[model samples]
Target chain A: MRSTVREADRPWARQGAGQHEGRFALLLLLPAAVVVFGVVIWPVVRTLVVSLYDVDSAMPGSYPFVGLDNYVRVFQDDRFYTVLGHTMYFTLVSTFLELALGIAVALLLNAPLRARWLWRSIVVLPWALPTIVNGALWRWIYNGQYGALNGLLDTLGISETPTQWLGEPFLALNMVIIADVWKNTSIVVFFILAGLQTIPSDLYEAARVDGAGPWRAFWRLTIPMLAPSIAVVLILRTIEAFKVFDIIYVMTGGGPASGTQTIAFYTYLQAFSNQLFGYGAALAYLIVLAVFALAMVYLRILKQNQLAGVE
Target chain B: MKPTSPSSGSIAGIIAPRPTRRGLLVGGSALGLSGLLVACGVGGGGGKKGGGGSGSGSIRALFMQQAGYSEENIQEMTAAFMKANSGIKVTADFVSYEALHDKTVAAAPAGTYDVVLIDVIWPAEFGTKNIVADVTDRWPDDWKQQMLGGAVTTPQYDGKFYGVPWILDTKYLFYNTAQLEKAKVDAAELDTWDGVLTAARALKESGVKYPLIWSWQQAEALICDYTQLLGAFGGTFLDDAGQPAFNQGGGVAALEFMRQTIVDGLTNPASTQSLEEDVRRVFSSGQASIALNWTYMYGLANDPKESQIPGDVAVLQTPAGPVGRPGVNGSMALALTATSENQDAGWKYIEYLTSQPVQDKYALSSLPVWESSYDDPKVVETNPAVVPQAKKQLGDMILRPQVASYNAMSQVLQAEIQKALLGDKEPQQALDDAASEAAKLLES
Candidate 1:
């Protein structure tokens, strides 16, 4: 009987126990897995399927599989390139400005001062605002005949006539970027401040002892120390900036001769407004690919910085 | 705290028992039960098969959330409806104009709405999708005489009436009488585009900043304005075979005239970004000497609360075009969903809403589609000027291209016309581009 019991409790039996544990873990995760599959994976697969067809929801079941035709058409369309350029312009300009201004604000908030907490909280107020609300606020500010910006300029003797801020194409896009920077820079500030707190004072003290000035110390110490955080912020902001829609929709509606029409807006026009479901799906997938490429570039930059830090 | 030894009595044994599969099963089931409850709560009520009643069942109607279709106003109308049909209950739902098309389309197959407010452009799509009911035989023989010509024709598709026109709308020339008098321009002389330009120039000389303001924003409004202009030049958007024909003949002159209006500084350059409401604001602020807008703006422009120059505003017949006076038909209609089980009640509600009495009351906010409503003492007392101006422009009104691809075509036209207006493209090139783009869209 003792020999039988030892044989029953062998390593094979332990393997069975491990399998049971794995099954139990899978059972526990089944609900979450199902939810994710239903919501995310299924939609993505459906979009890919739809992108192959010439579908209009208005005419149900009549869609024929066009097999890469939509993709070819999108590539051929000059407007697609134009709007893509607009998207890139918006993303790069907004992200660069936000990062530069965000760093300065983060350093200011990091300094020891009275009401430091209050000032830091205040700095995040714009970021906390809803994007649609931010867009509406900016639209009103840029209103041609009666706007706060025009009023201020008139008061300051900047321009004699009420300037139509959104009436011009290039200027309208720049104005939209300014509005985005105002709202998004605070997020960068918050992240950098978190990164700033993680840096030990000993490093800065050592820098000072080594006879480094504030500027040199900032370049060598603060920026390098904030690299990981900067990378995280840059990745998040770049992705968000690339997919910018609500702000542009509310502020410009891709107007002034389609100068402000971003790729996302163009996709929306094709899908919802024009009801070209198949083409829209293809355009959306193209945007996804573009965003993925940008993410890869960001990752490469991050990897290089990490290697430099290790050195 | 209890002190226990691991060999005899561990802390796990002392405090509580170890969790078992049975416990986890109970926990998981509880979580699942809560989730099921949420799912059930969300999924319930929507799928309750609508009970078709015997002339008294509840039917839900969806309306675009706008001036005349606010919740309060709808409730008032519903109260009146319930009063007349004591057994029937009308549930009114409001969706914004932006979401109306998609929401109605998505829900139509399931009969989510009993009665849908159909835009002037959507009857073709609705008819093709079998989303709306055909009510051709339902109209009385005198319907043509009773309703305005544009209103009667707007809801017809393939020789069947899919809807009943309720909100009669057309763009009209609303000029400030004081400003016109100041510029010494006779209202009769403003019957043609050339005459309007002369008056605008005179108004500009009289210190009117924006002598003409139009809803020229690159949106649906822009298409409405363009349609009016195109029709004025005796140009049709589509040919007999329903292909894009706006590139030929009179369309070029129409676009050139639009471009020249801005080039000559008669209209505001900022009008390129102005919507109907924005144009109304300019007119109401006594800045614009003349404005072109929807019929609803008449009441708002003359409302003392809404307008600074309420006493100075007056309406004129739309300017005469090369063909005739040109106005684009923009009426919204009340349509029945094909899937609605409560078809009888839905029909009753539509009949009630579009009835002469209700339409007269509606005339207080928007113009009534019924020609007879103009003769009502209540309408006459409310606004005497609107009826006459509307009647004068009745024959001049032209319908937008009634096609399934109208929305797409409108977008292309709006963008192309806006390009011309913004100096991004020349007039002829813009029209040619619009025609080609629209052809591709329509064929697709």
Candidate 2:
């Protein structure tokens, strides 16, 4: 009888060992999972849930569930549409300009210049500066009265009158875009420069031997090789440009008749200004959707390019 | 391990052999259940702890940025309040004035802040939502009367007081004395819009880019310009019943005057979209010969470190309109929250901050709402540039309409005003459409 009891206890001991190991594994993973859930997943879930309610942030716990009402309201708002359009317009125009200018600058810097390191370091200065500081600097540059741009134009005899760059509704958006491109093009330049360094010099030599023009060589050899880097730059910049808030907020506050209002600014206004949390959450989701959609398009293009390369 | 299911064991054998297995299974299940329960308990505990600490513990106060007030002044005020009231500790969160409004509105529902300092115009919008407490019966009668007359009135909604006026801000016309002399236009002649425009034209002919610089973009300045001109034309924005009255004759004439000023080039095309701060920058940078801005700019414009033309600045009333002189009076108000645990303590802090003595100490930093403080010798000596004009204008001041729907209404009016300025729509059409939209917002 005593031997049978001892034999039954063997399975229990093995089971105890298995359970202890399982608990130990869970303890290690639990902390990381908690952190991820707390910081990332929870906020996303809360935002989604809040988006379904009509929340007036001024009244605590007063938001009653109103399924899809906030979403519908956001879609119907003319300002929403206008800001969304401006965001798309800003992202598309600025990203394209940054890519083109960045490539140009990178190509120039990649050449065997006399002081290549100094030139490269200096080119990175704009990108290295803080965004708010850059915004304030650009705001000073665009001032109608004492701005550097106007002063320069005045000195050059371009116009007797100073240009109201930020004050004009038509020009304010363009001025902000110009400032954004100037500051961010350096980032793209750095990426492209890295990509350019990885390309084999022998490919260029072969193109030259084949009597290829500089433009032809760039299109066929350089660009094709730099496709991955270009894809990364486009995706990163597209998402960033779509969510631009600080620079525009500081420079224009979506003013001169909301001409410069972007989707991000509109979301802030809805969330913080109007205290329409549900609507703000819905707008936030819309912005996420926009970025995701653009990412998908870029990913598709990248995959197609990869397929072409394989063929 | 073994063929365990062959036959049922006798009761004594089964009971004696299964103790280890039973103990392990029970312990493992108990631990798993306990872990799940602990995870579920955190949220409820956080809420209870937060609510429990509301009154006796520390409270957070959100304040708008003061133009010339330093962080040290804020610290001093907080220390004084804490020292006087030993039971409560206050923490101040200062943000830019524009951002402060949005922050308070957003933070209130989350119970993230216990007290908020708001613009006087904001209480109407916030009051209707019941974010601010009604303190009509809570305040002392003498203290209420001691505030600048219309300043206290701006925080009332439907005959109930929701906030206490803490500071006063009024618009004043700032002219360059040297520019007036250079243009050879008598400063005394600039009492009316036509007179000012004529002087501006003379100054423009004298090579000044913008002779009259004022922001028509949005906010209080727009309301001030509109009201000053409209009241001169004997116009009112709303009737006795708080309905739209801007479609009347006085309103049309006022809008036309603004348009003509832009068309005639007396005021710059840029002024149509410039803010008060932008216009102030133009003035401080020595570009504008004349500008209309708030009283706070007087200190910065006179400070040699910040301003190129320090002593050259002088203040006067906004140019009188055809019918009467209407100056837009702006004020900042402080309100305690209904959710505040320490209501009496919060009131005491408000009293201490707005007391005549404390207000006098901060007079140079911000315009005091206390009438007694304005009369203080130190206050008069400190803010000499516009104190006299501010005092006089306080009597004739016209506040922007404090309606429940003012926020939405202001946006619509601002957009239409911008449209009219840009020549996209006529003034009448703009006002009519704005009125229609405002009606919709009000009804909704």
Candidate 3:
């Protein structure tokens, strides 16, 4: 009887009550497992397979198996490089601006104030708006003829002419980043605000006892404490900025000489508009590889911060 | 998958007679993935059509929104068609014109739509791709003679009828009579491109900042506007052998003419980023004195509720160049999707919609494709300002190059042309760049 009990200790031996618990857990997990496998795993693997072929149409037909050629083509194409440059510029600028602005606003929101809820709600309005609506709103504001931005500028006696904000390529890209930061900084602020609440007043008091001022205390105590949160927001915003598409679609449509085209938007143009599905799939995988590398960096920084806290 | 002990992980469980439950999970996923990959490989193999159905089932159709026909108008027409043909029920879906092409392409493999409204430029791509059915055999011979000459060619590709023309349209020169008169510029001078420029200068001198606004945004609208000017300058999109010819002779001249307008500040700098709707708004608001847009603009620009200077708006055929004037063909057609299961019912629905009586009834919303509708007193009365202009403009129309890869080529040209319009490149250099890029697209 004792030997029989020992046999159950072997992993997956299926001879005792532990087997039931394992099976029950699996049973409970089946729905979520199916969802992840069907929508996420399956499509990802299928796209990988498609990237190996020379597919030109959505309708099924004979297509030559050209392994790695499509991926190779992505590097060779001139427009790919052009769009990649635009995407990198957009991501870096937008993410940096969001982080800086998010921190400042988060500090403000975390401060003791009258009607804090009303202030927070008003600040959250832009973030609560759907990206499509935000994009359309900004497009209206940037309209060369009658945009509100120009109207305001004229009212303030700042300019004599209505500038065509979206008429130039580089300028259009920067303008889109401003629109993105304006909306996304809200999410970043909420994250930092939550991080702020987790901090104890003892740290600031202790810093004061050590003869440090408010600015030094903040830099020494608040920032270090918020490293984990900053790392989290950084990763989320970085990945999101890399995948930007819809706002550009609604606002610029990748126009003014394709000045504002990002990697995702270009992928869409290739797959749906140009019907080059295989090439588009290859581009998607490259994006995954790039994002994977980025995530690794973020995780390492998060782990380092955790270790420092533990010390 | 949940994180478990590595010693009892999926790979180990499968290899060691499933040491852990993780093995079972991993093994199952691998099997499923392999199966899916196999299925996908088969789909990429040669496949047969799945478009046959009993001609009487309910069919779904796709149409454009806020353009040729409003969603309300198309739905009303569909309801009328269903009432007449009691055996068939039609479901209509509408998307903006900007999304129409991609939406149709994405829906093809699934047979999600039985019929789709396609633009005039899509026949070449859709016919060759087997996305839309060729209906040349089913097309009535007499119907060809009945439709206007330009309308008849809307869906023709490589000697086959891919669709039936439904919405007939073209860009016409619309002007503000009040602004032109205030500038002392004769309306008669608007008949020629040269005279139109002189008129623009006069309008500018009279305090009109910009006298001309065009639908020159980076879209198909820009290509349409360009095609009109290309034709007026005696340029062909492709030479007889089908090589890129737009880089030579009249093509270069036409682009230069466009650039000069921008330099002179006679054409709105905003025109580089404006679509047809924007053109209408500026012209109607008296910010612009002369513009080019579709027939629909005439109705809206002359309506008091929509426009500030309603009574001052007038319409004319596109102005002549050094050569002759030819308007860009901006037509749409109804086509049976290649993957549709109920082609017979779909054809019946299309036939009813394109019928003269139905189209004539909707003349207030969109122009009729039938030439005889122009002669009808009621149709003329529906849009008196535009009907006479349409009679002349619709007779001479220029089509974008009928090529399978026209969309990609158009995108390249749009970007290059924009570069020229914005002063980043010379017009000659821009078209030359576009021509070289087009050559590669044609080869593929």
Top candidate (DockQ): 3
Docking class of 1: incorrect
Q: To one decimal place, how large is model 2's interface RMSD in Å?
A: 11.4
B268-384, model 2: which lDDT tens digit per residue? 776765677778777887778888777778887888997888998888877787777777766677787766656666677777777777777877767777777667778899988
Which structure is stronger by lDDT: 2 or 3? 3
**Share of real interface contacts recovered by each model?**
0.21, 0.28, 0.48
Candidate 1's C-alpha runs over 4 A off are A1-28, A58-62, B1-60, B67-71, B83-96, B106-112, B130-145, B338-344
**Native-to-model Cα distance after best TM-score fit, residue B311 in candidate 3, in Å:** 1.9
Predicted candidate 1 versus true structure: per-residue lDDT over B1-61, tens digit per residue: 1222354367657667666898789767755555454333222323323334466778889
Model 3 spans with C-alpha error above 4 angstroms: A1-15, A301-311, B1-52
Indicate the worst ten consecutive residues by lDDT in candidate 3 chain B.
B1-10
Docking level for model 2: incorrect
Best candidate, lDDT: 3
All candidates: TM-score of chain A: 0.92, 0.89, 0.92
TM-score of each: 0.87, 0.85, 0.93
i-RMSD values for every candidate model: 10.3, 11.4, 5.3
Q: Candidate 1: give the TM-score of chain A.
A: 0.92
The order of the candidates by TM-score, greatest first, is 3, 1, 2
What does DockQ give for each predicted structure?
0.15, 0.19, 0.41
**Winner on TM-score (2 vs 3):** 3
In the range A1-311, model 1's lDDT, one tens digit per residue, is 35346745665676468789989998998999779766866566666767877766533354676889999999998889999999999999999999999999999999998999899889999999999999999998998867899999999999878878988778899999999999999999999999999999999999899999999988888887888899889999999999999999888878877779999999988877666778998999998999889988997987676556535
